[model samples]
Target: MLKNKSWWSQTIQCHMQNQKSLYIFVSVLFMMGVIFGAIIVNTLDLNQKNGLINYLGYFFRQLKENSIAEPSIAFQHAVGDYLKTVGLIWILGLSVIGIPVILILIFIKGLVIGFTVGFLVNQLSWDGLWFACVSVAPQNLLAVPALIIVSVAGISFSLLLVRNRLIQHRGTIYPQFISFSFLATGMGLLLIIAAGIEAYASPWMMKEMIPQVSWITVPNGS
Candidate 1:
């Protein structure tokens, strides 16, 4: 009886450790993707870079100039896009085969964010840096953490499914599945709030910061 108890304790500890390790590994992979994206943005040629800068500048300028702001419309669109991702994570978390795909999705999300920030800072210098901090930072403050948490939960649940199937564990998976669903639902709600912030608050912030952008001036003497 004592031996059986000891074995059970060891098994539980091992499972906990594996879950922790999985979270750390997934986070590292996402960060690596972000770094890779930054590198890609930084390596573009001057002409292409200039084009990108022009497009971004024009877009920002328009946002600043436009007096009629429709934050509700923006919120709907943002929430819809975010829900697509939330849905993917929800559906994928149940299947053991989804682990890699979910990880890839998380990485891609991080990459996009990193690329946008890196491009802004690289192209605009200090002005771009401030713009990024003001416009990008607020929404992502909610979004990035929520995404990471959902990813960790999804990956962990998928691994649990794998362990149950591979080891032929006798316990029923219904309880675990329910728990996973609840975790995902909570995370989804957080993402909705993030979408709201992105739509409503981010634009206002950008409009305020746009005036601070210093345009390059040519000297007649040159």
Candidate 2:
């Protein structure tokens, strides 16, 4: 009984430690989002903003009828995208020097998202807002969480590699690698689901919403 209690205690401690690590890594992603969001807000000019407004209006108007995409094509695109993302994570996790680079990649991803949403919100206001919510939010609900998990796992594995190599820490690399691979595989599946939603559900949702939404008029060449 005493041994069982000790084992349970150790398991709890380890679980807590893993949770803490995940939180730290996710916080890094969050900080990246904030920094990139600010950059988008600061760098966009009037012409660019106006162009974005027109583009968004046109895109949404078209979305009402033209948003249907082939499911197989969507699946392929989604799988390809997942491969690109997980490939980076896997490659970066293998190298000691890749830790910072992986973080930077995560930052760039956040930047792109922030910029896209920011532009949409700034240009169309409510129309842009609802469009983004319907079109972008659905897939991201699955994809982003999967991304964050894989990213955190990758960062942790990379840090482990760094510590084992540079800091001369005696740690098991093989098991960690297995864990990382499994995490990536699971996340890849989740991302594929996200892609399915993006291709089929998101477009459908946008098409449905587009007819109902009225775009706020933009000034000509403003």
Of the candidates shown, which would achieve the greatest TM-score relative to the real structure? Answer: 1
lDDT of 2 by residue, 1-222 (tens): 999668645743563378686657676786678467746765878887777767666666556447445767877887798779888888887877777776776677677777777776665577767877987788878877677777777777877888887798677799888867867776787788888888778777777776555554423433
Q: Rate the local accuracy (lDDT) of all candidates.
A: 0.76, 0.72
**Best candidate, lDDT:** 1
Instruction: List, residue by residue over 7-73, the lDDT tens digit for candidate 1.
Output: 6457545544657877678778878887888898978999998777676766765676674358898
> Where does candidate 1 clash, by residue pair?
none
TM-score for predicted model 2 compared with the true structure: 0.80
TM-score, one value per model: 0.84, 0.80
Clashing pairs in 2: none
Range of the 10 consecutive residues with the lowest summed lDDT in candidate 2: 213-222
Clashes, model 1: 0
